[model samples]
Target: MTAEPRTHRTAPVVAGLLTALVGFTSSYAVVLAGLRAVGASPEQAASGLLVVCLTQALGMLWLTARHRLPLTLAWSTPGAALLAGTGMVDGGWPAAVGAFCLVGALILGTAAWPRLGALIAAIPVPIAQAMLAGVLVSLCLEPVRAFAAHPLLVGPVVLTWLVLLRLAPRWAVPAAFAVALVVLGASAARDGGVTGALLPQLAWTTPELTWASALGIALPLFVVTMASQNVPGVAVMASYGYRVPWRETMVVTGLGTAAGAPAGGHAINLAAITAALAASPDAHPDPRRRWVAAHTAGWAYLVLALLSAALTALVSSGPDGVVETVAGLALLATLGSSLAAAAGPADGRESAVVTFVVAASGVTFLGIGAAFWALAAGLAVRWALSFRRRGTPSADAASGGAERDAEPETDAAAVPDAEPEPQTSTR
Candidate 1:
């Protein structure tokens, strides 16, 4: 009889492990790629992997324990992609670190100021989606490049990912990584052996603030993270009928980001897709037990953190394009979704196209990368087009009308999900 209860308890625990496994395997390669693109050495990238895992794991545990809700956090995969797109800045790694610190500060500022959050929400979704799609285009093409450059090494990985995507979409990325692991092992044997420190170690670099990094890296990273991860995370949790304490949650994540920045972590925010994995009915029959799933997932990420160094070492010693192939495959779905989302609201669709082309062009001017320029150009075109439309003003004036209409709903404490399900979120 007691054994039955134990088995019931095990359900959420198992689900939690699956959540962590999927979450980690799905995107850690992208994280490493982002760090390296931003000028991190192999050791620094290893530190980054370890620190992001630690901060997110600890953040999840604290939030779940405190609120008794399945509130989970993740390193910003979109932000990492932005880093990869931005590449090495004028000041190199230190500048990137400074930009990370700035993103954390911006997140904290949003929590302290409601207007800030509202402003972020006000940005047209299509522009953000376009920018993300553009950034991903270059990375998503890695497989094509790899297949052409080293067909033998890249072919099996693509085949594995394609087969699993048809059979079990969720496991597709992880399966691709598994096949790549075999490829890497063979490459290592041919090269004699793997190389890199197996033990986890911290590599700290004092952050150096520069105007180029600030405008190019910080602002874009912050916007992508907010639009893709934090906003969608709130919506996902609300879909489960949980009124996430938005301000408090932001504060925790913001603080965690700042704490991890020096050690090479970019940023951390609420988990969107993975949130559903733990918060849904699939996690447990009783809603209260759902928090246990998040808590268990936290421990799972902690375990993964221990392996970060060794994984980093293997990736460093592995053949070129093999790891990039894995990262690119991992991001393909995200790219497709972002592209689809970018093709919306016919009025500004052209603006989104302009944004996409500019960003994908990989053009940089005055040390500012294409992402910032893409948004600027998109907004410019959008305004120019809107001027001619001469439509009546807007359905609602601004926050004043919104507040008046939502007052009653606010009194009822019904969670309002103002954001759509993000197609751009990696995890």
Candidate 2:
């Protein structure tokens, strides 16, 4: 019998820090951009960052503890992208805040209503995985793209990651993070030493509700966050063989968003790529112990939230693509696994390919992102193929029918036919 492996104390700690680092460094700038797009001042944007991080951190802790799963909550990155694209709405930042609140309420409703939750859960495994792979493909390409763009900056980081992967696979991502920090620090030192107060700030803006804002911002924000962020997040967990509590997760994230909206924060939902980092086997060999990594990551996010002001400045001062490269490297393993899961099933191969292509293409239709359409296209293809196959008669069936019909003798003793055995399907 194989012996149980002893748990390593450092594994969970490293996973947690990596998760926190990836969460902040990878997308905080986009969040700041989104806030500004809606007319939030620099201080307001900083407060929004703090609020979103703190709120999501609490949600992560509560959800993971209650469910005993490695669930990570994050502000909706796609939703933020949507905001950045839309620019200032009719009623300005206050109106955007209102939209944020409305989106939270809608998300909460999905959790409260069984039918909605069931619909989300009922998404077929292959289709969900395909959608996730599509969502992640572009981001996953960034490491190599970053290296090609800035060899001097990203070369050492990528080399460090590769070296760690060969010698100590578990530490590969963390080593990359370290190398990035060193590179960024060196760059900053050459120009001037970084300076910022590591203090949390609170800037509250009362929401101003308007029908125009609701249609222009709230509805679209909710749609993108759910389709591009939350759904794929669920898919990520499922890809890793985790049965996430979808309804509870939605409700918790919705509540967190509602709590943060007044402070200029937008939507918070289940994380896709970063959550995979904490939940992966790399965090711990035993799946049961992986939750410790996510829980620790949640607490780490809280710590970062307290220092959001300084953290924001530090990230802003760092060179472009540094954070993206690190984030991409961190998720390389996840991207591989997700792609494998999405394409592994022969029956779903075409559908999954369609989903992956559309998602990675980043096309938008009628204000909706490509992710939702990719899922729809994949499901349609799956259904169409299944229908065609079921209707078409098999060669064995045709031959068996012809043979039986050709027999002249009707008596059972004259000639007996062997019945076909049942086939058991396997993945």
Candidate 3:
């Protein structure tokens, strides 16, 4: 048995703090950029940043405590990236707020109607894992890229993590974070000691409904969010061997998104990369106790929200790749496991590789991110490879064709975030 007393004590808290730190520091800029791109004023963009931190903090708190699972919620980074690329719409920031509201309603709608989440769940396990590995490639590369760019700054942080990995495993990530903070702090001290508003000012807009805004903003926001954040989040957690309550998760996150929209927050959904930080074995040896990490991450986020104004300034002014390097280090373990799983069983390994390649390539089509297309491509490939003559029975130890057709169920359930439906036919 992994010793109970020592293992659970500080590891989860460290994991939690690390989760909040990386999740916010890495993406708050993108969130601000997205809000600004859609015509939010400076104050409005700050409000967006402030509210997303607070709202998603609450969702993570509620979900982790209620279900006792290592579930984390985050602002939709991909959706925010989409926003950054999109120009101002007809109703301006208010119209963008209207779109945010629509995205929330659509999330709640997904909760009520299970079809969408179900279809996602039906995707095979190797394929889901492949998508996750693909998604992580860009993030996992940051450390190497950071060190190459600024070896003087990022090198020490990575060295600290590596030394600790052999000497003391659980604390490696937290130590790296601590080192990065020093690097960031030293950089800030040189440049006038981190000056920005400690108090965040809120700017609220009364949302306006417009057809142009709906088409230009709302639909696309909703689509990219579900495809990139929610679905992949479920897959990520399931890879760690957890079943998220689909409807309940939607209800909590949807409520958070709706509540924060008026205050300038965009979509909030399940965390993908940071979820690995909290749920991975490094958090704790016992899977059951790992929720402590997620719960701690929730409280850490609340604390971060109070400090968001200060942190926003610090992070914005700090070294470019230091924080990202820490984040990449944290995800290294996850990337290793995912890569191994992506190779999968012999039958589906080729399709899984296709999925991983597309997801890692980071291509976009029809305003949707690579993840959606990666999954689609994998499924298509699997179908083509599995196709057989209608009347011919496959060569197998099992006698009947019934057994061969039922195999995907066993395969998909390897990650149980979504359960597969039993097959039924009437002749």
Q: Top TM-score: which candidate number?
A: 1
lDDT digits (tens) for residues 116-225 of candidate 1: 65556555677778999999988888999999999999999999999999999999999998888888878887998878898888899899989888988998898888
Q: Candidate 1: lDDT over CA atoms?
A: 0.83
| Descending-TM-score candidate ranking | 1, 3, 2
Tell me the tens digit of each residue's lDDT in model 2 across 52-143. Answer: 99988999899878877889888887666556545676678898899889988988877665444334434555565566666566656767
By lDDT, highest first, what's the ranking? 1, 3, 2
Which runs in model 2 stand beyond 4 Å of their true positions?
A: 1-49, 60-103, 192-198, 202-250, 261-300, 395-427
Index of the highest-lDDT prediction:
1
Candidates 1 and 3: which is better by TM-score? 1
Could you tell me how far off, in angstroms, the CA of residue 268 lies in candidate 3 after the best superposition? Answer: 4.8
Residue 269 CA error for candidate 3 (Å)? 5.6
Superposition error at 37 for model 3 (Å)? 12
TM-score each candidate.
Answer: 0.91, 0.64, 0.65
